[model samples]
Target: MKGISSYADTGRFEEISLASSSYSSILYDSIRDRPDFKAGLSEQAHLAAKFESEAKYSVLNGFSYISKHVNPHKKWGMLINLSSFAKDANLSLHRNCIYCSKAVDLNINAMVDNNYNTFYVAEKTEAGELGEDIAAMQQYPVTADTSVSTLLLSNIKQGERAIIVVPLKKKNFSHCMNFIHHAGDGIVVDGQQNKLYNFNNNADKKIFDSLYGAASSAIKPARIYITGKAPDIRNEAWEMIEHPYFPDNDWEEL
Candidate 1:
């Protein structure tokens, strides 16, 4: 009874119209000689018609929702810069050195000296409701090729510090830097050449403080250059800083 009423409200012609004309006619003729039988058949026919209409509408609404919300064909590109670490001799670039290296096995430092640190690059494609999946991707070696290169060496010379320069794609460099900081790696403080230095472990704290002081006093600004695009999560996670360099459109297909 409830289903029949719902069917009437939705106005699904396929269920009510066809049944009312075809099936109802047959039932009516068969029960014409008996008033009780005819009345009962008509009541069942109305309920059946209503149920059919509701089913059709429910299916159509479900499909519409999926089509609007599901991003089955969406794609984006992730460019990672493994170059700086790849060219550095002080850092260990071996496969067993970094976390998750065995699983990703990018061999990014192979393009540069073996002593360099290895970084990762990835591109991703998203499906309906599901997150991104790494598609065609690669990694390359990166090195400080600018005047601010001194900042890197100076931090290393300080003995317990490692200098990291994350370049801003545009004016909003803080957004990206904050992401790396919150990831539990370290705290980012101002450094030379627009670069920020972060220290994660207790051992590196002094290094961060010293670098922060030195960078603040230095006349030359630090340069933060990335060899490749960072991962999707890293990019999205950092909302404070906007990557001016990130392209406006997605390019997962390429």
Candidate 2:
């Protein structure tokens, strides 16, 4: 892969990401001397959420990918409120999400405003492969890892286009699960609550099949329920892993 720096086109702002809308706008800055070029993209993203059926899960998985990358102790699923982030970033499409005002909404406008390159992320289709633990432990013969966000937003955009160079914020949490337990209720993104419960305990794990939501309609989990026909296929060991931001965290005083 070529260096991401190859994509840089900003002047003052560090070119950390990309964006695109249907038409064009002056909301964001321009591409240096190229004043014709604009920044901030939103329309395509809203349209994506409008069409996708499982956008909530996709957004959660995207956050999961982010969590894994941004020095997290673990990468369990997360929940985010569109209004919270949208309002922070000044993207006014929070009311247009397909899930309505659900905690987990995918508004690219807000994401872009918040400095995420949704266009770039939407293009991330195949994520390579499953981890050894997941591959071996999973019932089916799983191989490569596909993208969930791609499922949420295809090549769609709103009426405007802009290229925003996002500053690399120290925090990559997006205030998903790691934060925002208050401010209101939170919807478990595609039922990652199961993993949250199982993995949160570190040493302690549930032997019996634990469940969430209404008992009448309660299912194993979005992923497991889709495959595991038998309700009793919940036997698996758990272990905590140390995913450090630095390589092996071997830094010593020189």
CA lDDT, every prediction? Answer: 0.21, 0.20
TM-score, cand. 1: 0.18
How much is 57 displaced in model 2, in angstroms? Answer: 3.1
Give residue 32's error in model 2 in angstroms.
25
Highest lDDT against the true fold, candidate: 1
Off by over 4 Å in 1: 1-198, 211-218, 229-254
* Model 1 residue 221 lDDT score: 27
Query: For residues 162-239, could you state the per-residue lDDT of candidate 2 as single tens digits?
Result: 111111111111011111111111111211111221223322222101211112321111111011111111222222
In order of listing, the candidates' clash counts read: 15, 16
- Model 1 C-alpha RMSD vs. true structure (Å) is 30.6
